[model samples]
Target: MTQLNNVGIIKKANIYFNGKVTSRTVLFPDGTKKTLGIMLPGEYEFSTDLKEEMEIISGKLEYKLSGHDWVTIDGSGIFYVPANESFQLKVHTVADYCCSYLNE
Candidate 1:
C-alpha cells in the first residue's frame, strides 16, 4: 500500500546514524505497530529486538542479515529479520520503507 490509514503516529522521530536513518512509530488499532522511515545514502547497522518484516517501498539498497550474504533490493522488495539479530544496509539512494514488528 502506498499510504497508511487509521493509525496513530508518535510525534518524536527515531533518529540514528547521526540522522542518516530515521523513522516514526505507527500505532495500529489492533495492538500492532509499525515504522515508516527513510534511509539516506549511507551504510548502517541495526539490531532488532523483535522479528521484523522490512518492506522496501522505493529506492536502491543492499542489506545483509546475520549469517547471510548481502542482498540488493532495488525499487521495492521485502525481507525478514529474525528477533534478537542484527542486520546491515548499504543505502545507495534515498529509500522509503515500512517495517512491521511481527509476533511470529
Candidate 2:
C-alpha cells in the first residue's frame, strides 16, 4: 500500500449505481480532488466527464475499457478512464479504490 500524507478536508458523497457505490471527496491543499470509494460485488458501468485515474486499494475487479478486452486488477493496481468515455467493471469481491480526477 502507498502511504498518503496529509489528505485534506473530506466530504462524503453518494456516487452512481443508484447509491450502491459511495465515496468521499477529498480536497487537497494543492487544489487537487480525489474520490475514495468502495464497491460491493456487482457489475456496473460508469461514465467520466473528466479523465480519471482509479487505483485499487484492496480486493479485485475485472474491468473493460470502451472497446477493450476485460482485465483483472488487484490491489495497488491502477487504471485510466478517458474523459467523456465509459467503462464497465465487474467486481467479484468488495473493492476499495481511490479515483483521482486529472487536470487536463
Candidate 3:
C-alpha cells in the first residue's frame, strides 16, 4: 500500500558553492526535515545537539566520529547519531547525502 501526502512542501533552500559543493534543505510533515549536500574532494564536519536524527542518503562518504577511525559509507544507509556528539564526514570524491532530522 502507498500513502499520498495531503500537505505541501513547507520550505526549501538551496546553496551552490563556488567549488563542487552544493546543499539543499526541505521541510516535510511532522517536524521532519531533510538536507541534501554535495561535497567535493575534501573533508567536512557534521555536528548537532539534537538527539533525534533519522537517516542519511549518501553516494560516497568517509566518516569519523569524534576523531575516531575513518569509516567509509557508500550508497544509502540509515544511521542514528547520538545526542551531544560531534561527527565529521570526509568526502573522498564527489559525494552527495541527505540527512533527515527532527525539525522541532
Q: Which stretches of candidate 1 lie over 4 Å from their true place?
A: none
Best by lDDT: 1
Worst 10 residues of 3 by lDDT: 1-10
Residue 10's C-alpha lDDT in candidate 1?
A: 99
TM-score leader: 1
53-84, model 1: which lDDT tens digit per residue? 99999999999999999999999999999999
Q: Rate the local accuracy (lDDT) of all candidates.
A: 0.96, 0.87, 0.61
lDDT of 3 by residue, 26-89 (tens): 6565656666667787776656776545344556677777746877777766555666777776
> Candidate 2 residues 1-104, lDDT tens each?
56557877465576777776889888777888888899998999899999999999887899999999999987659999999999999998889999999988
Which scores greater on TM-score, model 1 or model 3? 1
Residue-level error in angstroms, candidate 1, position 5: 1.7
- TM-scores vs. true structure, each candidate: 0.95, 0.87, 0.65
